[model samples]
Target chain A: MNIDAFAFDFQELNKEIKSSGQEELNIDNCMGQRYIGCGLSRGSLRIRGVPGNALGAYLNGADITVHGNAQDSVGDTMNEGKISIHGSCGDTPGYAMRGGKIFIRGNAGYRAGIHMKSYRDKCPVMVIGGSAGSFLGEYQAGGRIIVLGLGSDQPCPVGYFCGTGMHGGKIFLRCGQLPASLPDQVNAKLADDVDLQEIEEDIRQFCAEFDLDRETILDHPFHVLTPNTKNPYRQLYVHC
Target chain B: MQIDYFYPEYEVVRNKEKCTRCGLCVSQCSNHVHSYSEEHRRMITDDAKCVNCHRCVCVCPVGALKITGSNHQFKHNANWSRRTIMEIYSQAETGGVLLSSMGNPKDMPVYWDKILINASQVTNPSIDPLREPMETKVFLGSKPASIERDENGRIRNNLPPHIALDVPILFSAMSYGSISLNAHASLVHAAVDLGTCYNSGEGGLHDDFYRYSANTIIQVASGRFGVHKEYLEAGAAIEIKMGQGAKPGIGGHLPGNKIVGEISKTRMIPEGSDAISPAPHHDIYSIEDLRQLVYSLKEATGYKKPIIVKVAAVHNIASIASGIARSGADIIALDGFRGGTGAAPTRIRDNVGIPIELALASVDERLRQEGIRGNVSLIAGGSIRNSADVVKALALGADAVYIATGALVALGCHLCRGCHSGTCNWGIATQDPALVSRLDPEEGRRRLVNLVSAWTHEIKEMMGGMGINSIEALTGNRLMLRGVGLNAKELEVLGIMHAGE
Candidate 1:
């Protein structure tokens, strides 16, 4: 099913898409059509223009791709399937996603993977080719977030408070120096062979998806930020 | 050696003569407070470890055990109370924020006790529930101000989905992880049998319980745990939990130990990792943002389920509820300060938020003043004890009342307020295998059914005595209620005339 979403209402477009009985949907000129592919259990969506906030929210097992930039909350609480963005996305992208992978070619806004949790094999992965804003992976219980500094030469690839309240999961940032003065709960160290090996396949997949040299991306020093302890708060608050 | 800062609040007492030295208490005490002594061939108990859960006492074969308040005394002052002194000492010792469980146990003025219900007299004779047609049925959702007909003058059924309740009572939000799966199953079965609903708190709904989806109210809090397509679509209604009454401005942290097994799989978080729901939805900083979330859920569910916006009863509760009425929500749930929690900072639990009675009266009044009272149904929670409370809440302008602590009690919770430890012996609040197994869902469901059924009967009797046949007629009927000892301000806030008027 092909939809020209230039002047069509978002609700109407979604209604038509759901009733069209097609697994593959192509939407053109999709400017700020919010909640695209929302709660879609099946089907693959291809959007030509920028989608709005909460794109693919609670997407159970669908695949979505945007030729242009996407808005905030790209895949909020989405369970399964994949979302690939061609350009930059706004804040809280992939927030609290439990399953599937989100690949972005350009930068992402604040709270890229806040509260992202992973369980068993249903791990969620978010890879950003460019820089990211602050509060990256904040309160991240699980899942993997890899930010590759493919663009500008910033000292640190991400902004401040990176991986704050991170209990589980690993964050890979391509940078020379660590972000300054991390919280007492987290530790930032240069990636060793073992750390690099863990995310090697994901990094390769990211590079392969965005057309980048794997060897060149691997040669640069990468910094890993991890929580000092997963559950540091055990009966910390004791009332008399 | 670690220094003991405070003494045991209660000491377990055992009758040596009655104790048979069978070691049953040793096996029953999950806190490991009891140990069998080889030297004396008797049970040695630790007073400090006793949470007074009564697990041992309840399981004792010889009916010889009881917990007594310790006689330990301190050089106390009126202003500097014992608890205050210990609190200061504990803070000085560890510098930690105080954590506690359950609802506030402080002796604040209980407004429900202050307000009196009036019975019909000779002028209007009371109707007997046994003989007369009494109704406890309540439909919860937004009702149009008035019915509008179509072009042909035929009545149109354009109302949104509403929860049909045989009683005004519902089992409130106690998340799957916070309580055991068996407990959830019990609530599910009970709600189904009682023609009411139970909430899936913030924890995501387990796949096994989807059969009871019609009786569930899946919650979408700041954490959005276990939330997905099927979860949102499963429930009869969806509740957006903005704030809890116990800890108004606080988030939640389900510790790593409890986040194992099915809980981890259900919540989709790693095993043995802290699940922290932030204090506020970062995206929702204003009312417009709140409206967007409400509509987002509505769109997600295809508008098949009613959206309930739950907010804590605070100082500005009237204005907050007023704004919520216009937020496209079908129902507004007001949780007072006495609401329960698995774990909360003690200060907030004891000090934050107002009582539900005041909040409900004011919110109902405010929505009515704004002429949007029909836009949403009002539900009040926060320590609704019995049938009388439910009736009073309805008369005070609430369409229904939610009960959590009562439901837990029906499932064998002693309200030890140690739910945060995840070692509930009666099995209502714990995820531990043994403790959870102790609570048979079949038996738990029976007790729960009995509790709500009894409440329903009592509610009918109360309504019958008021000469009101149906709950819809009794709703917001403040004339049937009178203030007992309340002053001018309290009477005005409650919108009830003083008794003898």
Candidate 2:
């Protein structure tokens, strides 16, 4: 199915896309058409131009490949499936996403993977090839976030206040030095051989998807951050 | 163990002749004022532990208890009375916390009471609610961008996804940890029986109430406790709790002491860990960020459920509601300052936000001005007291109203303003298993259903008297309301006219 989104409103275009009965969708001239392919399952969407916020949001078992940069809140609160972004993405990339894998080939804005959680068998994964802005993985309860600085030259690829209130989950950053003022609630250390082995598959996949050398990426020192305790705020508010 | 102290204000006295020595008061008192002595074989009172709630006086079988002011009297003056002097002295002793409950008990102007409803006299004939088919059923959701027709000129997709209600009233959000399981069960049962909805209040959905998912609105606050796939998919709608009216700018903190067993399991946290919902959703910094969350929930729910944005009524609410309207939300729930909470700082609860009435008026006007009134349905809450307030709220342009205190009142909450203590005498807001079991879901649900049904009938009657057979016509029809004693500013804020010319 081939549709020009500039001609119709998002609702009309979405209705045509849903009713077209085609497994493959090629949306051309897509400009700020929000909620495109939203909750779409069992289809392959290849977006041509820049898609709006929440593209492929709550995408359940579908494959979405965006040709260009994506807007804010991409794959927000998503449950499953894969969204491969060819260019850079916006803020809160995977906000509260419980499951599925979001791979960005370029830089991501602030609060990437904020409030991302994991359940019994569902662990949401977000991998950014470039640096992330401030407040990375803020309030991250569970899941895995990997930031592999491929082309960036800065000594520290990630921004300030990384893992500020993080109580769960593990963040792997391939950087020379960790942030100077990491919050007291988080523990940061050099990724050991076992830690590198755990994320080797994800890193290999990211390298394979974006066409990067895996050895060059793995050669740099990586820092791993995890929450200090299971219950970080147990003694803060009330007299228990 | 006798300790001498100065009695500043009041004392509790017991009439020995009327006292039956049943020892019920001894166990009921939380402050340990009354006790049973084995040697004396009778009950004894320790006067220092009394706060003068009059509970013993009211509960005494023979009216044996009375409270009196101790040696604290004012000189005979025309301007001041003894009670006034005692009140000041009591405040001085207690260091001026000024705890209260229900609504504002101060002598300020209650605009809802001052505003009068108008009925049809001659031009338009009034209809009887009992006889005529008056429409009380309301659906809260986005109206639609535009009701367009196909090439055949037939109606196409007239309804947006909405939660249909038999009555306009719904049970507001009171989490399981804040209240008890029995109280939550009673509310769920009442919502089912009355064909309305009850909010899960960010505590996460209890496993036992999965059968009542259609009548539930699962909440996602900053804490995101117990928010799993099943919880998200169970509810008819998802509400993002941005701010609560009782304590705006403050997050919810169900203390570690209260998080026990099922409450802890449901929230998916440790047994004694504080379930802290941050003041703001750390992710959302702007309206665009808010849109991301709204759509995320929509995506997670497969776009089958409508999303509701619940925000406290604050200053600049009109503009804030405009942003919410454009945030892809189907419903906007505005809570006023007088809303109830289990626990809040005393200062924030009393003097923080504006009234729901004024907020509703301004939001309605702003949405209509933006020509996006049909895009999002408005549900006003915080302090919707009775059927009359419901009618006036509809006239002020609310699609529906949410009620918490009123429903609790039906379940025997005495409005004693003691929810913070976590030992609700009525068994409505406690975690203790023994206390929770006192409120039977069956009877409590029946009482709530009765209260809402009675209010619905009254709403229908009021609409019928106005010659408005449908709730849609009654909405935003400010001509049907007139202010009786409100000043010009109050009238202007409420968007209604002063009484007669």
Task: Give the candidate number with the greatest DockQ.
Answer: 1
Clashing pairs in 2: none
lDDT per residue (tens digit) for residues B312-415 in model 2:
99999999999999998999999998888887655577788888989999999999989999989899998888999999999999999999988888887877
Tally clashing residue pairs in candidate 1.
Answer: 2
What lDDT score belongs to each candidate, Candidate 1 first?
0.88, 0.82
Across B1-501, the per-residue lDDT of candidate 1 in tens digits comes to: 545456788899999889887888888888999998788877899999999888888899888889998988687667887777778778878889988899999989889998888888887779898998888888999887678899999999888889898888889998989999999999999999999999999988988888888799999988888888888988999999999999999899898888898998788677788878889886677787688678778778887889999999999999988888999899999999999999889999999999999999999999999999999999999999988998899999999999999899989999899898878999878888988999999999999999999888888888888888999988999998998889999899999999999
Interface RMSD of each: 1.7, 6.6
Those runs of model 1 whose alpha carbons end farther than 4 Å from true positions after fitting are: A197-219, B1-7, B16-22, B41-43, B145-152
Each candidate's TM vs. the true structure?
A: 0.95, 0.82
lDDT of 1 at B72: 89
To one decimal, what is the Cα RMSD in angstroms of model 2 from the true structure?
Answer: 5.3
Listed per model, the TM-scores of chain A against the true chain A are: 0.96, 0.95
> A136-182, model 1: which lDDT tens digit per residue?
99888778899988885888878888888788788888888887757
Error of 2 at B350 (Å): 2.8
Model 1, A29: alpha-carbon shift in Å?
Answer: 2.7
